[model samples]
Target: MTAARAAGAHADAVPDLVPDAAPSAAPDAVREPAPVTPEAVAAARHDLYTDGITACRGAFGAEWADRLREDIEAAFDEARRRPGGAVGRGPHRYYVEIHPEQMRGFAELADHPWVRGVCEAVLGPEYAIVELGFDIPFAGAVNQPWHRDFPSPELTRTERRLTSLAFNVTAVDTEEDMGPFEIAPGTQWEHGDGFEHGMFPPRGEFPRYESLAVRKYPCRGDISARSALTLHRGTTNHSATARPVLVLGVDAPGAGNDAHHDMAVTRAYRDALPERVRAHLHCPVVDELAPIVQKHTIEGLVMGDA
Candidate 1:
C-alpha cells in the first residue's frame, strides 16, 4: 500500500495510520479508533515508515509556535549551532537551531489529544530523541534531495530497533507552488544491501527508492510520524515567504550515529535518556551540557562556544 497516508487526499478525520489490510471499518466509515499498542504502534510505524516519509504539518500549537520561533532566533544568535543537527544533511535550505529548553517548549504542545494520539499510535512511550534540527525559510529557495534514512540499528551494535519521528511545521498555507516536499513511499522496507548514495563516491551512487508527493497535513499542528530507513526529499519552496519547521529524528531509546562522539551538548541529551534508552543508543552518553551549537547568520558579535 499507500503506507498509511496521513493528512492528504482524505478528510482530516480519517487517520492514514491504519494498515492496508485493516479488517475493521467500512470504506467510508471512520472506525472506533483504537488506542495504539506498543507492539501495534511499532508495527504500524514500520508499515507507515517502510518507505520512510510522513508529514505532520502544523503539529505544534500556536502559542508554542511563536515561542519556539523566538527561541530559535535567540539560539541562532548564540554560538555553537550545528546547521542541521539530525534530519537535514546539507544546505538545500535555511535553519535556526534551538536549545533543549526551547525544544521542551514544544513538548507540552502535545497536550492536544489528537497530537498525543498520533504519537501514541506511532512511537508509543518508549521513544527517545536522536536529534532536533529546526528550519527557517532560506532567503529565496527550498526543497530536499533524494535520500534514505537509516535506522539506529545499522549504525551501532547497541541499538538495532529504532523508531524515528519527524515533524515539519509550516507558518503559512503551502499552496501547490508555495513549497512542497517530495518523497518515495514504501522504500523503508527496501533492503539496503546494494544501495548507495546517489551523489557520493563517484560510483553512480544514488539513494535507491521511490518518489511520491510530500504529504501535506491540514492546518498548523498536523504532523507525519514514521519509523526510519525511509527515502525522501522536499519540494523547492517557490514561495517568496518562508517555511519554518522543527525536524526531530527520534529513535527507540539508544539509536544514534557515531559522528556525534564527544559533543558535550549532544552527549548530555543522550545521557538524559532513560538508562534503558541509553543502552539502546549507540552514541556516547554524557552528563554535561553541549557546547553552544548556535552561531548567528547575521551580526558578527560572537557568542562564545560552550
Candidate 2:
C-alpha cells in the first residue's frame, strides 16, 4: 500500500491504514460490530500524528455505501437546481455542503466506533463535528493545484499540534482514470513561505510534491482521515464516471473551523439522535433545513490547471 511505501521513505509514514485487522476478503463485506480497542486507538493516533492520515478498509457494508450514494445523487440533483447551491471546484468539478438530515446514514457514520475512537484519540474527547459535504469530479475535471484544504492553524504551525481532521468516504470504487485523490505524506508539517492564501503552494513547489505524492484508490465502504493541511490534489479525470466522495470534518475545541461551515439539523432529527452523537455536533438545531451556501475559501481550485 502507499502508506507502507511512503513510510519507508518518510519516517513519518502512516501505520494505521488498516485500523482493524487485515481488510475482509470482500470489499463490501459487512463487518460485525466490535469494540474499538486501546491498541487500535493508539495506532490510529500515532498515524495521524506522524503521517497526518489514517484509514479503515471496509468499515461499512456495501449496502450502506449504496444507500449513501443514492442520497448523494439526490442531494447533488437538488443542489444543481439552485444558483450557488453547488460551488465550482474547477471544470466539471463541484463541491456541496449539506445538512446532516440530508444524509440517511448520518448517525450511523458519526457514531461508528472507529470514527469516534479516532476523533477522541487525536483531537481529544471533546472533538466536534463541524462539516458534512461531498466533492464530485466528473469527466473533464482538470488537475487541481497541489494544495492543503486550508491554512494551518497557529498552533499547528508553531506548537505543532494538529487541531482538525477530515474524513473521506468514497461513493464508488475508484479507478485511475476517474482521477484518484493524491496526497504527499508528511507535507502537512512543511511551513513553506510561498503559498497562495496560505493553502496552495506555487508551481515551483509542484515537483517536490509530485515526487512524494501517492494516489489513493479507496473503494466503497472504505474510510480515510487526514490532516486538511497536507499537500494534495485531484488528478485529471479521463473517464466518464463521476467520482463522488463524502467529507466529514471534525475539530478539537478552539479549532474554529465551525465558523466556516453551517452544519445544521432539524429539531426532530436532533431530538431523535443519541446523546453521544449529539455531543459531537456543534451546529444548530433549526426547524428547517436550509441549503448551505458554499463558504469554502479555496479560490485557487475554482479554475483548475489547463
Give per-model TM-scores.
0.56, 0.88
Off by over 4 Å in 1: 1-60, 79-92, 95-97, 109-125, 137-139, 151-162, 197-211, 215-218, 257-291, 294-306
Model 1 lowest lDDT segment of ten: 297-306
Count clashing residue pairs per candidate. Answer: 38, 0
Overall lDDT per candidate, in order of appearance: 0.42, 0.81
**Cα error of candidate 2 at position 197, Å:** 0.5
Residue lDDT tens for model 2, 48-120: 8787788887788777877887788777766665666778788777798999898999999999888999999
- Prediction 2 global C-alpha lDDT: 0.81
